[model samples]
Target: MESTEPQRYRFTGHERVFHNVSAIEALPEVMALFGYQRAFVVCSRSIRRKTTWIDRLHARLGDLIVGITDEVGEHSPLSNVLIAAKQARDARADVIVSVGGGSVMDMCKAMQLCISENAYDRESLLKLQFVVSGDGTEMLTTSQAPAAIRQIAIPTTLATSEWTPVSTPIDDETRLKARFVVPDGSPEAILYDPALLQQTPVRLLWATGIRGLDHAINTACSSSPHPFASLLAEKAVALYIRHLPNLGDTTATDSFTQCQLATWYTGMGQMSVPHGFSHWMVHIIGPYGDIAHSDAACVLMLAQAKWLEGWVTPQHDRLLAAIGQSDTPFHAILHDLLAGLGMPTTLDDLGLTRAQVEAMIKPALEHPLVTRNNVRPIKTAADLRAVLDLAWRA
Candidate 1:
């Protein structure tokens, strides 16, 4: 069931969309086409080692590969972002190409702002004027003074970070969570190729698929659910259910295409309402335990959704139906899906102890976005502790 969540906030930007069959064929042309003479390609070490697509891209683009950094991890820490920005500056790159999952994309987006001098200092990143009252309007805003650093995104994992304007990063000095600098820095081009994702480890694909699902579920059941966002979320859930199960056996080009599109849809949906408790908790868990973002996300989804059941309304049921599942207790169906996919439906599976659950109370409650969006207010540490107790044990 949905809550009587008031609709507030307006979304911005045009969807600059593109899809290609091969990264080799598309990378050079897209770069050249977008007038990006040279770009800094940022990826994760895991991604670089597993896939030869970047090598092929480098071969195709040649000198256009102005700089390369593969240090992206679960979160784009400020140190990494600064290192990347320095590398881009050294290379004199005018464009940024990110070629992994959400983390890589987040890093790239942040680097774009940093390299452009819009947010030269980390402290200044948190002080930008938010365009809260605009309706799909574009304005030329400056931050330390805007310099051109175009973005070209090529996401390999299904975590949909490409569709958002913000990036999550950890502060270099303080180690506190910080959002990467972004205002009017949407990607100039996006290239989605399914084969590159085929190189992704099966476990990561499975895990990120769950993260994609969380995006949809959170958006559908969000306090301010929009019809457009709900449609994207519903489609994402249905596609995720079908493709993720047979991800190993299925090599059909269409399967990967569907997964890519679903992730994009989920990304767009999430950019509106953002994520809720599951995401907040997962974000904390991944960095604290040094776990994969997707792994942390999948493990927490069912438990968090189960917790949400207590607060659900009829609108939640309608959303479940819209996502191609009949509205019986959604927690049961979601748990079954998790079990079948070999994802942990419980927190204990991740090696969290009762003590760790107790520890999660403060961090989870402290996440401003998730804490604020909760339909049921988290009034005190006691309230969050009670929820985490159930989530921890489940």
Candidate 2:
């Protein structure tokens, strides 16, 4: 039963968005709009070493690029972020231009916070994060105001970090990820070029497509669902179902653009609604088990759907309909889609032991975001362990 009461929707708008082949050409105009002169570029070493895109971008930006750092690691670790922040500061950067995957974008966002707030070390950065209370309540902490500098994201994957105001950076000592939520943490602009996306590894692109799918599914089924968000999420689901299968073909540039559009829709949906178990579980799994964020979705989404079996709302039916599988069960349909994409469907497939899965329960139960935003109430560690047990196998 859907609620009939009126609802409100709000989003932090980007200064500009460019989504076509001419996206790279629009960077100068966007920089002018933001009054940004000196740009510091952040990306992964792999992108810089293996691709000529960075060189082309440099030729385009010319003298505007003050510095470039390609040392961003897999999970945006705290140590690497500090180094990037110092590099940006030393360069006297006026803005950040990130041109890689989610990790690079996350590193830039974290660096922005650290540079603005004068949190130069791990202790200071950790002090700025929200913490979970003994009773599983999240206590959010606010920063001073907006940072002086902003970021421009040109994502090469479907992880959709470009559209969110949240940043997750892993701590080196604790080996746990911490969430940083600043009102102005979102990028000022986003460029989604299909040619740039074509440069990404097919396996990586497919994995992140599952990540976007997770965003859409979780948003549609959120406990506090908004009608507008549901509509966007439904469209995102349809787009992915239609385009993701064809994305592996090098000639399918149109498919790449469509998938990018789907990610944008799901990214908005994620911002509009709180996520559930799969997202929360993946955050924990990524750092603890050394799993990629998107790969964790491959292993956990089915089990999370199973946990929500009887608890799911009519939105599940809408999802089934969007995927053209109205008569099929949601979990079965999801499994088949993942299998088709060559994604892992179980923890064993990801090379995780049952004991490691059990170990995650205590931390998952205490995680602020996991405890606060789950559609299904997680009352105890036992409840989390139950879900973990199901997720441990296919």
Candidate 3:
């Protein structure tokens, strides 16, 4: 969108972001500032076991770190969040220090929801999901009462979940994802340290970097794009293209640090930009297919680029220019990137059955963001199927 276009972007409750700083060292001053004493530490299992970060955290905060849970799963199952919430409550934690990637960060957010809403029972929180109408209309039926707790984050991956307040924990009982937005729930501060990145596996790092790349691409092509957001999104694309494919081989700290900065740029204007196409499709497909989000990005973005090859020229051209890949068609460029990263390039590659793909269609079509803001208007089953077909290996 033109800068002249009227727009508004409210930065979430997250107050400050510190880069290349020790998250543990920054914790004491941030905690004292907010009068946060008793702390609940929710971390990924890898961080707790593979590395000494958790041990370091325990040593740094001492008695102030009231509780810790490392039972966090890959997708952040709702049962996991519920159980962790009970633990945090029993320990009387006043703030949550979330240390992990997207799922861990969002798990912390849902824990806050469970504690604040007093809806510890899996059934209670499951019912809190907003209803979506057949025509893609949605009602915001979440509790009016403010969310009980807030978060401070130390990120271990480049998914950029710490930068947003929204959390989606999968409901294990139904195999669906639940969305929650808590009052004062955004991170109070986010500390980004490349040393933390070392704990994340190279494949995981590559995957989440692709997720960050997904964010940047969709933001740039958003239906209601903002000039400032597009600028950052474009910059993120260049950085990701330059650094991502080589991350695993080089394993250099400079490459990791630059990817972190690219991740931040990807989601910095999330509030201002409304993304479409692959972004919304991933939300539905990732949960339903049990595919990791970044994996979904691998399939969907490549397919969507193919589906949009000639349809959205100017936006595609700008993104092509940003990545210095104007000579190649966008989808081919994406295909080569996936090849370079040794990532999957289709839905069939993830073992998703045709039945699962069909089952996802109705909900994907009804999703509010897909309906309202998809780059191209989706008016028929054929329109949605076109992209899905491109994404499937067979």
Candidate 4:
């Protein structure tokens, strides 16, 4: 029974999106449009060393390339972000061009904050980090200063970090992650080149594709549903169902493009909806156990589906139809899809132990996103532990 209530939605402004085989060729024109004379490149060390894509970008940008910082780490460590920020400042860069995965994009966003607020020291930076209040409300402490520079993201994976207005940087010393949400944190423009995506490792690419799927699933099943967001989520699920299996064929450029589009749709959908326990669990597992973000999602998504079994809304039926499963349970359908992609479906497969799972429960429950934003209320440690246990051997 669909409710006849009138719905409203808000746009996050029109960002220039370029998608083509030659999308990277438009960087100079994009820079001209923004009056950005000096563009700094931020990416992971692996992307810099292993691929010729950076070399081509440098050649194309010519004198506009101010500096290239490849020091970004997995999870966007604060120390690394500060280093990158210092480099960008020294170069006098007017804009940032991030060409890699989620970590690199997130690092650039945090670097923007560090540069804007002059937050150099760890203590000063930590003070600006977001915190959860006693009553489970998220409190952000961004400086009043406006951002001096913005990023033009060219993502190589389906993590969809480029489209989000939030940045999560991990503290190297404490191994705790902090979220920084600011309106200017999102990228100013995005270039989706399927050819560039071919440089990504197959396993990582497919794993991140599942992460995109998780976004669609969580958005579609949100307790506070938005009509437009539901439409995008359904399309995202359908696109993934069609293209994800073809990712192993290295030459499938169209399939890669479709996956990127699927990521974009899911990213937009999740922006207006609430995510559930799977996202929170992935956040904990990534920092605590030193696991990759996408792999963590692959391990926990089915467990979250199991937990939401009876509580899920009718929108979940759309997800089932997308995957060609009419009467099958949502978790079972997801398990089969992940299995077909050769993704890990259990915590054991990800090499997480019961002790580590137990250690995650307390912190996971305390995180603002987990406690305040989840569809299902996570009130006690036991409730979280039960979900973790199901993920352990599911």
RMSD to the true structure for each prediction, in A, is: 3.8, 2.2, 2.6, 2.2
Candidate 1 residue lDDT tens string, 299-363 = 66776676677686664677567656765677777777778878776667777777766765676
For candidate 3, give the lDDT of residue 195: 79
**Candidate 3 C-alpha lDDT tens digits along 1-394:** 4457656564677778888887888888889988999999999888898889899889999999999999888679999999999999999999999999999998998888888889899888876665443433222336666767788898888877887767778878777677765555678888888878877888888888888888888878777677788889889988988888667754577887898899788868765666667877888988888799888888888887787677778878998898888888877887888888888898888789888898888888766665566666765677888768988852
Q: How far does residue 64 in candidate 1 sit from its true spot (Å)?
A: 1.6
Q: Model 1: how far is 124 from its true place, Å? A: 5.6
Every candidate's lDDT: 0.71, 0.83, 0.80, 0.82
Off by over 4 Å in 3: 1-5, 130-141, 249-251
Off by over 4 Å in 2: 1-6, 131-141
Best by TM-score: 2
Q: TM-scores, in order shown?
A: 0.88, 0.95, 0.92, 0.94
lDDT digits (tens) for residues 1-394 of candidate 4: 7767554454543368887646468889888988999999997777789987788889988899999988888899999988888999999999989998989998998888888888877887777766554533234445677888899888899978877767888999989887886447778888888988888888889898888888888878876678788888889988887888898898888899999999888877676766777876788899999999899998788888887787774667778877677799888877888899899999999998888888888888777777555566666887787777788776
Highest-lDDT candidate? 2
lDDT of 3 at 153: 90
